[model samples]
Target: MARVHAPRLIPDPCSSAAPRRPLGNDDAAAALGPHPGWARLPLVVLATMATVIASQSVISGAFSAARQAERLGYLPHMTVRHTGQHEEGQIYIPSVNWALFIGVLVLLVVFRSSERLAIAYGLGVTGTFLLTTTLFLVYAHIKLRWPLWRLIALGTVLYVVEGLFFAANTVKLFHGGWLPLAIAGIMGASMLTWRKGRRIVMAYQSDVEGPLTDFIRRARNGHLNEVPGTAVYLHPNTVPTPLALSENARFNRVIHEKVFIVRTVPANVPHVAPQDTVTVDRTGADSDHITQLTLHYGFLDDPDVPAGPRIARDHGVDIDPDTARYFVSELTLLDAGRYRGMRKPFTLLFMAMSHNAAVPADYYRLPRERTVMIGAQLEL
Candidate 1:
């Protein structure tokens, strides 16, 4: 349909009487009108509405993508608000929305016209197409185990088409095409740095936290004074003892009478089954009153720390949510003066991202009044 009408919508440069103004969507709308009269007004209005709907869809998609990235550990935790009760994908990310708004404002001020902006848009779209095609081909080959000849034939055809599209846009590199590429580069760098930094920080934390089983055994042996309340430690994994729990035992020299080490695991699916949400490990809970609770949440599911206890009760683990005091770790990154693994600038970027990330209490929906943050410093 577009190919059939494009010639009428676009002016021919070879024509001597063609207008000097740059062609755009407005021109296309005008072409769709019956005549240069009242018909033009309605067409323009319709075009405007269509553009608005498209932009809104893009913004909503961005919110979902950002939320998923944060959940999957590709990005820093952001404030995600579910806007729809029945739809798990209906979410709003204020940070992403604001960033997009600012980016659009800057682009409008700099480019000033659709003709100039098209260069960057074309590059971004074509780049995405090329990458998506490559990824699809790779997935088919590796996962589906496509025969070598079939893989080569399909890949050759797709790559040639995508390569041509990408190569056509590369000529506009200096003329605003660099904007999208630069943005992609920065975002990719940030995601990679955050993932790597998280691993390094977690390794350091695990080393410092020692072993969870050992700590539980020591507490069971009456090595520390027993307090009379339930303490819930929110941790990323069940492998290492939570830094908050270890820190509390170290500084206060007291262990809670009943302790629950809770770890919220982000599953690969969109929504985990309600029945499979909470699992309790009572390896030593019956004797020592120390239990290990694992909460499974999908990328779209909310990680409510307070609700974990209620869910655990269904699994035969009794926990009082109202009186449980939640403990979380607040990590402060110290200067890594001579770190060799990650560059200094990337380290600084990671620290800045971590500093701005949503607080654990808010992210996990823990009770603010009963939540306690244990500060810990990590150098490198």
Candidate 2:
């Protein structure tokens, strides 16, 4: 009690001050200045990472792992998956582990190739990075309403940083980088070819509906031509309309010649044997040329499936859809400015090769022919 009283009377050091806690929000903001900027930055970094990973997934999903590894000299050709007896494209594809596995194996077996792998994959990543920068600049202006000057400054800085990576990746070109570059080229061209082919198909469909339908009606009725034994309407993908057959009947102007609307779609599953099909009657077979309607299927999924009669027959629509007399109305561009870029100047020249290469057949499952070439140029 005495001690307590003494304490009560005794000194308080500077008004009973207590130990201060650790520096937190205010300290950090003071240290960083403009605190929310820190939070915003993590979001931006996360978005960028998502884009890069997604890009890798798309590219890897399309190509095999071993073949992709080959670009950087990871494995010998013998180890790669080869195309089966009937397949056309490259065979050895990649999975997620193949990417890292090869890179690791390369480091263990042959140190030099591993370094090249690092450099080679870097280009694909950097190429996309540059694309991201370019696209994001356009996006920021629209999304954030950033002023022109700020956008330019930010864009310029991004370009410089990303450009450094691009330049660094280019160093690999001398050491087997060209192989991946060529693969990239093939992928880009394939995409363009599919687009051009679709354009022609749409144009042909437009003419088929009205005036073309009328012409067919007269012909079928015998004002213009006699009835053929079979009118097979061929389409590259699944779901061909009996339009061609419909037109044929319209020209005939009488039902009784059977009509066959056949489609050759490609399936995604690899285990699926080449010959797969679904047959159906379009509008209950309004007395057209179709003895049987067979929908052919290709090995690759429908989208990647090329327009070819051979691929079509894999699914069982093995009929001759194109003849010397049969017209394939086609419209394509040698220079469709749609797929434009600095890294892709070759696009301008390659589009010509793609357009001029004899028109691909609407897939219907047969040994495809390469002769028919009908080129149509639409209004620019």
Candidate 3:
């Protein structure tokens, strides 16, 4: 039997006349042979599988980053689900996943093909590369102890190359690059608004709340009603007087027998052992009965406020289960207009976020029946 040769459908890379270019589906199929059905099937399946795996990896990374940002106080908190028993990094944020799903659908519908989407993808990749390269320069120079000349040399080359790539991608801004830029803008604006709102709110509270030591002194002298039971007030810092406690005293004129001002600190690591995460400091005189509790959590850990009793007991202050009450301060953004740092549109956005953010009782896993929310109005 004589063999018949099939036509060369795809260009050979080794040939001088065949210029390198992205191969189309048709080219791939044709390259297989005249009867290319079976041969091309595996190739198509492999390519699809690779794409799916890459996409899944990217989505996982996005979830991890979003959760970290939320923990770091840059973004609002979302419910996180741990998929693995021992893997702290295996987290799923429903909101982020849904948003990404919708985003992917919109992109697919709008772009229709990978050719058009590549511009936007390229823009995102280049922008991230530039940002990472910039960070690397700083880390290399300061932390890695690279020589000044070496640092400058490495940074300049990386920056020049990445900057050029970013600049080249900018040409596609109107075509498809606008998508990532718009997303980036929204994220940047959100992060900025949160940071500014937090700063302004904290400063306002600090100015109004007064010193913790002074409050403890006053409380000891019988300034407020010494109510039965332990009162746990969650504060951002170790401020002796928490906003919740101050408000309770000013309005209600009441204080619990043993007052605990607790603050949960987030560590950069994945998981902090429970035993090593709690610190208790007994403040004021023996008669005052004021204690400060600081709980440390890994960036991935869910904060548990109900553990306050256990933590207190570990430090020798036994909290009565029946009498304990958790107090949280809720912010009401008064439409009295904007304040310093946060202005107009962004301020409104921040206010909306603040209004919708998860309540302390829910986010910190406090006992709902024993939690008290005291609302305070703020201008910003």
Candidate 4:
């Protein structure tokens, strides 16, 4: 008798259509149940309060004094450092922790005007709260298929909770809470700028890289081009612009005609289970000569998961391996003071430690030597 191992069943990768099913109450109910009256309503409200207030208090009252004192004209000492969580035992700054207690205590006794900052503070905080709640409502209505009344009840509570966070944060602001508000404003602006920057950078990237077809042509004509029955490319979730797309086409000199960009989504809480996969929507004109596939997976999914070529093989789509190559772009980050924070070395180190760990490129069976890494310099 011969020992045998059963081959695993991989999903069909190149299919444009997803598995569809009729809307049944059971599935809808199960989905709706997650956002029950308590979870979405009361429980979320409680968690929100605990999160916002506690965060503000810790940031301001706790370490706030040490940071402010070191900056100001008193006994100046204690340099601010981003230690990068070297100490396994300690979670945060201890000296600052105790100092905040003292500072808040002293503020309570001396500063009678801690209320004025509340108004300025409340605007940003409250607005975010409202926006987040509204987004939740929209998500619930659109995705979960919750009843309108139930959605209202859930959203109303969330809205009210966000309202309270704003209200309370506002009160703190007017009472000499400018720092927190200022910090929030700076953070909000920074986030917006970062998002915009990603767009600009992506646009520039696609442009510099040129279109896949052009790159493929160039590769075919030059060094980058090689024997290729297929090639899979991985991309970040940050969307690409048309300019970048055109550029990518031009730079590549030619395109794989067959490519895949798999992205990993971040999860709020860690849980391992039936990991969902998303197909990346491809742009540019479609030709049987080339096929671009996008896959979306989350952290909960094992990073070493196989995709595309594997799927094609499992699904019986024709693809030749010895000729196929996997292409991955490496993003190198440098800490530039242009963003107004931390040294570049530290940021780069952090990034290095956290490279693509979830999945190795060769997991799909293209082999390491066959893979190509294009170094991409990220905009600081």
Best by TM-score: 1
Residue-level lDDT tens digits of model 1 in 84-132: 8888777888889998999989999989999999999999999998889
Error of 4 at 359 (Å): 11
Which window of ten consecutive residues has the lowest lDDT sum in model 4? 70-79
lDDT of each: 0.86, 0.49, 0.82, 0.50
- Which portions of model 3 miss their true places by more than 4 Å? 1-35, 40-44, 160-164, 320-323
Across 186-208, the per-residue lDDT of candidate 3 in tens digits comes to 98899888878888888888877
Better of 2 and 4 by lDDT: 4
Off by over 4 Å in 4: 1-169, 174-183, 215-231, 236-290, 298-305, 319-325, 331-371, 376-380
Looking at model 1, which ten-residue stretch has the lowest summed lDDT? Answer: 1-10
Name the candidate, 1 or 4, with the larger lDDT value: 1
lDDT of 2 by residue, 48-102 (tens): 9997897566555546543333232232212224456676454544333465565
**Model 3 steric clash pairs:** 212-241
Q: What's the C-alpha lDDT at position 319 in model 2?
A: 43
